[model samples]
Target: MADISLLYPKGKEVSTMTLTEESINDLSVDYIVESLTKDIYEKNSIKKILTNLTCDIDVINYRADVFEDILNFPELRDGLVELLKKLEDLRELEKFNKDGDASSLWQLINRLREIDGYVLCITMLKNILNTIPIKSQGLLDLKQTIEDIYNNGGFDILKKDIDETMAKAQNLKSVTIGVNLDSVLKPKNAGVISLNNFEITNSGILKNFMGFTGSKEELNSDEKVLSSHKLHPANPSLTRMKFGSAQQGANTNVHIDTSGSATGDDPLSQSLKKVVTDILKRMVKSIKATLQKYVNISGYSLVGLMPEIIFYIRFAELVDKMKEKNLPVCKPLAVPDDRVAYGEDIYNIKLAIKRTKGEEFDIIGNDITFDDEQRIYVMTGPNRGGKTTFTQAVGHCFLLAQAGIYVPATKFNYSPVDNIYTHFPADENDTVDLGRLGEESKRLSDIFKVATDKSLLLLNESLATTNVAEGVFIAKDVIKAMAYLGVRSVFNTHMHELAHHLDEYNSDDSYRSKVQSLVTGMKDGHRSFKCEIAPPQGVSYAKDIAEKYGVTYDQIKKNIDNR
Candidate 1:
């Protein structure tokens, strides 16, 4: 009954938020998670957490403190890593015991194992609490709760008696079974003949091994002696087969129960285990009575915290690496108010990750803000001018900030969105049946179905797959609907007309969210990759590039005449 969580505050631990798969992909969440968790333990579990967002104001705030504690206090993180190791040991014990139907004896042993693990965990918690100044409410409460459990829960008594209980359980290794049959010669009742330290080996060839190793005269004396199976293998102890779930996973001798049916051919080993378990189950109950008090504090609960711990650990490590690279990674300010998200000097984190790999390239950092005046942006830019990169970067800032991790920005202040929805253009091939524009239209409609006024939307080149007029026609309505919903969106497209008419949506008093134009600017006839809030500069790059490269009519005519 130990109520503990790394993701939620003391009173709130029973909720979750999930982003659509399209959103997960559109934001490049998979790649970002992979970069964070590369070569780390429990990677997929970390990925599960990273992809599933939580918008709870309290939970997100709790996690932010927890992450800062981990990032700032290396001693705390080291201590938690030790705790994680103990948790891993506990998990191995559970995994070992999970594959079989536990008898009373095995169950008691399992309980003892749990008590031992819990004791170690409690001691580790005490050490962690005593040594480190844990700032986060999550970790502070966790260690405090564990100490409370130990001090008041009679765990001290359990610790004092654990050694005796474990030794008592381990003594009942082998049982001598004597089955009683009815008059029809079928099993009616069974009882243990004795509990022996050693089992009687009765292989087909092992009744007498002296004849094979004896002198020639002795071999002749026992002339009727016959060889059955090979010479009893090597050693009896080593040759014995594993029973009742001790699997190595890939082999039959492993601890896991691969025997699907209870009816097995081994009368002495396999079949007898069930009967022995039933007979002695009640007898071991008294011996385990002392340890059962703390069994409610299942180690698996502590094991459940593994994913959360790994999430923080890996992100902290990623942040540490980025710090080493001199990239600014700041803890985001989680604002509760609506219709506002602001970030400064924010670059694509994917680009930041590449910087760590010794790759040389200049990353363009851009500033953006969303408010009533510019809640929705119609961005037009030159091709390969970082329109998509800048758009994706904005989504990343919101996502990483909302998840309570440090963002790849110098500073970011944001209110938590209920969820972020993305409509990054899909593969044209996938739109064959619905047609590219039709499929995209349906997709955008689907996003509007769940998006709220507080949601952050990033649309990368929506509706630009067809002719500009048609694409612009639908794109304008999309912007209008966003205005009506008061949702914050970044709509980047090549359709200049789409970016041209921003006041049309803002002039309508019914629409609360205003649409504005943004563009990736050009300097010295080269794409600057800097995004700014302005009227659509509209990519007239064909004329500019033609003029720069001397492909314009006057320049070409002058060159021909001179030639």
Candidate 2:
């Protein structure tokens, strides 16, 4: 028997889908590239982008390989590493020299030098360390040692040793003629015997009295006698002992054993050995310290370059794939100066739209320069002739230009609008039950709530479903309100009577300069339009649009002919 309630707890169960790791990785990469391109395209810091890209690629590749436990993916690692190297090379080029021309190359060279030095050393160490094999107790012991050292501030000790060793080596290079000692020994008979004045030679020792011979060089005549003396009685009567010199003319070749009981058990040989060992240890520590410092510095430096490096690598890969498929590569066209200048001048868009389906897309000409003067533009155009598209294009262009991307026009001149508010083609299902008009009113209200004098408002057929008179009244009031608030607005409507009404209102000297109309083309086959700030002339294209929507043009012509 099954319990139905227990089988599905909480009455109902909903299954949710989540993005897989691969999908998330791809999205992350895309986001990184997009964000980097948007942020750094005009900064000329291409190297930074490349560095970031390479770092991300390395991280992803490493993660994938680890999770899959596949060590044979050398190609994956190599490709990423190669891209990183290239970016690193480029970054180096930027910091090479201080002189103008030479400086660029020097900058690159310097950066490469630093990166190569740090990367090579650290990678070599990691590879070497990873190759060590140990089993059971030995492995555990080694692991514990490493953990203890790393976790308990062992680096500081190593760092100090390194500093001391380097300094000692630098001092040692200038000195010569140091005393030599063999093994230091202590005995009750001869307190502490110093093994000094002994010469080690390849042909065995030529010392006095007790010389021992062997196939290999053993204790020489002088070293043997000295050894014997340390084992002798430590009384003052046995003050000195002597041995022969391997070299005949050298007086310092004879070994001397001294029983200085006051010297304690410390041997000269032991002290020298400790000094030398300490020096060597210090040297090793210094090298490690330098390498660690390099890692720290380079890690921080590479962080800044990650974004660009990642993007370029991906973009290059994309380009390569496209080429392999023999596909056309998309290239951005050069932005025109007129557009940039127009963008500098206008507070509002007169008419701005990109290429739309079945529409001949060209930006209309108008001296739409709005500084502190003439900020509002009320446009009346036929439906299906591009009112919404134009508004969107204008807003998009401004955004793109400000973001340092190319605008879609021969020329652009406009002011820098603080914000761009749009009310166009929203999802009907997403709208509240109060209707599209109500939703639009709310959107407009929100816009007004946040909009400032420097803000731009783009309204497209905003109250179209309402009565024409009410719509016109609302539009007029909106425009008037915007004007009073010193905010710029571009209103697109089909109210022909509203144009006349605007004309009447403009007849007053006060409102004349504030309001203006730039009419879009009527139904014409020319596929081009002109814009001017004057009272609209010629017949309105509203009825034509209505007829076109209701019946085919050919049918309309036939009906006309039959009539």
Candidate 3:
């Protein structure tokens, strides 16, 4: 196995990624799996653990598996060790109230516990390693060899030899080891060594120094002796052994010397580094071996076991630790309401026109209420009135309520709707094989196909581009379709004829009433607009507050005057 120290030189670094409530809520099992896969790749352990695990599982199962792998990874092994260490630190910090907030940490723990398989993998690996007894004899041999080498003048001889070589080489009068004297030496010693005059005058001395001794006629005889010394441990014909176990021992000593010691500085820091490195190495080797066993026993391919192992291990450990400290872990469900009032309840804005300079502002009250039986409402008013605003507000309110947020209303009562369908005004310039009237009819047809009684439909100024007589006729057909389908809906239009038709239909005592009109009176200072709902009763000025914001009295007057 590769050195665990190299795998995790430092404990796994804690994630600095900040999580928000929105982000947490949006998380799905797929997201969790993808994240784990990414982390494994980043740690460079994906090929070792995750590649073989991907073949058999579906998306959710795959994610669960990857999560297991993360917990068992060596970096995370050290991280867990660090976490246990920090638990003590945290306890200490708690005494001083310096731990800041533990909510996020607790959340992390709970999420981990929710993934118990990952926890099991980690626990099992740790247990396996703990069960392996240390080799006392091998350790004793190592210690004894080190002690003998140091006590028997071996270190002193090596040190003296190195010191003498360095001192003598430092004063070489005219020679450089690897380069000409002028090129190798600094400016201060440029002329000290005469490289041009250097030569090997004593061939015998050179050959003896390099350990090559043979007659000039028998020079080739030494080559065979040297070759045999390299291949075999012993050769009697060889005066000096070219390679031996002693040389291997000396090479090992040199390795230790070059590697340097971990002391002469902060002893605690050195000890900590050694401890962490050793722990990480052990963790990596143990985890890899255990993971291999999982592959063997489960008969699940390597890739499949990878994610399952990672997720369960990491998630379980996290959750267990989180539970030990009491923290919030559960997610919230969606709320239901029907009568939406703006302030205390959810607020939704429909076509809420913002004011531009010189342009009138308008806000129609789309606030609606539905009981167990009521299905539809028909809103009627003249041109430039507040019909559209009311339609839009209703749409906005339903959307906001479904999303589980407070609306602008003071109080709201509503059934949770699965879909909100809208048939607002479409552009005349939009490319369509049929004209505006054909397009409108097609849209309504499409809506009737899927819309159920549970769906909320909002129709604004539907069929108004044609004559009032024909528009009301088409409008009545659309309403009847919605009623037949049992879909709850609100329709806004300028046709008073349709309102009258609905009134006459509701007047029959036998029919259950569904359509109602919001044609209240409008009072502008001393002026009063006729209220259609209660004839001769002045128009409710409250409706005009919305109109005054956008529709000017002049605009209404211009249309009425032309009619």
Candidate 4:
């Protein structure tokens, strides 16, 4: 079991990062993950998988293949879901054995019920294995292993022991309790002195008065009479009580007792309780001896199936939702490590979420490419002009691609990054202790310290918390560092001046990455939200805003005349 993992390859160490809640929120990764897993899984558990995005391509592709196979076979997915639900209860069953407490008769009954659950789980798996046509090696291996276990003698032993034990457990019909009383009629002692006939639960006067002499073939399936030894108890607390004398049965003992008040608890009742407890202990010991081996081996393997089941169920649900909504989700081609990172028809997934929520707004998709000539983009645009949206979209696409899911784009190709680190602006409340600018600078420095050339950086208004002069000065150094490190990045900002030194940064032969300017376009006084490779538009955005608002001198005069 130690060598098994649904997410990781056998013998390969699982490597992942512990992203902070702030970082997760900053990138909207939580939003995307929750949206996909909504109504399918609890938010907290689903968020864990989203935060721990794998940097390993092999593991990512492996899970993707497994997800595809699940999506292809609806019956397989449904079967696995039912099995996983039953398997989820196994955790509670496992806890009973973790502590060495003695089992009560009542507790033993509950264990029998859980054992029934285990029996059902095995039968369900056997049926599923026989039905689903699994293609992925991960699922195929699981199927083969389950088949082997089913045919093993251990499985037969488990079935036989469960049947026999359950039969024995069920055969207790009724108990007759006898209590000794004092002068005040208080019970001084109590014991089960006799076992009675099985109680009839159903009440029908005609049936009680008359006996049916029907042929076996004429009786209904449920109408079969219980044999003497096969009689079952109505409840867990009731057990067969053996009496020493048949002469004790009389109406005289049913009269009220005039016994005196008892000074202490009944010793007879205490003795009887111990007797029942000891009997329960022996029964548990026998059952454990018969079933422990199969439980030890099969229980663990089933537990290990939990994560694999969750992964398939969540992804398959999202895939179905996307198909129903006609959203575009395409498989990405993972480019080699040394190749360029690029995506076409790239759109922000956040917009897709809005559309799913019944928003009628149109979502515009853009394209981005990161190659030797333009590895770092200094994106500048007016506020609300889609700079932040486009920057986050690029990061989301890469993260989706690496996770081996369909990207939001129609086509995407990416060199896998070691990790993604985001530096979206901190909230005023978050920066209050350190002051806004100070906190921003500290986060930027931390990002630089850990980031590598193979990492993808998503910077959204990072240094804009400070004054223009200071921000531009610091932004230049950060851009220079990014270029020197040769990492792929999108630094979207309101600092239009940051785009001025592109030629200077590109001229440095020591710098490994080229710098380029990107701007969100404005057409006919309306924000187009289309990002492209071009120089900054500068004050033209303010002029466009004025014209659109009718605040320009000529537009204002025309508005006044029309009014």
The most accurate candidate by lDDT is 1
Q: What does candidate 3's lDDT look like per residue over 462-531, in tens digits?
A: 8886567777788987876666565667776666566666655444444432555555345563222222
Better of 3 and 4 by lDDT: 4
- lDDT minimum window of 10 residues, candidate 3: 249-258
How does each model score on lDDT? 0.74, 0.41, 0.39, 0.69
Per-residue CA lDDT of model 4 for 419-451, tens digit only, reads 788898888888888897789889889888988
Ranking by lDDT: 1, 4, 2, 3
Residue 457 of model 1 has an lDDT of 89
- Higher TM-score: candidate 2 or 3? 2
Give the root-mean-square deviation of each candidate in angstroms: 7.3, 25.0, 22.3, 10.1
lDDT of 1 by residue, 355-440 (tens): 88778788778888887678888888889989899889988887887778999999898887878899987886888899989999
TM-score of 3: 0.36
Candidate 2 lDDT, 1-563, residue by residue in tens: 01111111222342212222222232232332343345453223432322221112222222222212112233433443454564454344334333353322122224334444334433432343245432223223333433443345644554454445334333322111122222332212211222223333324334321243333365444544334222223323212323232221111222211110111122332222232333234444544544454343342243343333343334444334433433322222222212122432121122221121123433443334443345666676655555555555555444433322234444554444455666654468856686776776777777788776656667776777547777777767777667666666667776655556654544445432356676766544332344456555435354455555656567778889999
Taking all chains together, each candidate's TM-score versus the true structure is 0.82, 0.41, 0.36, 0.79
True-structure lDDT of candidate 2:
0.41
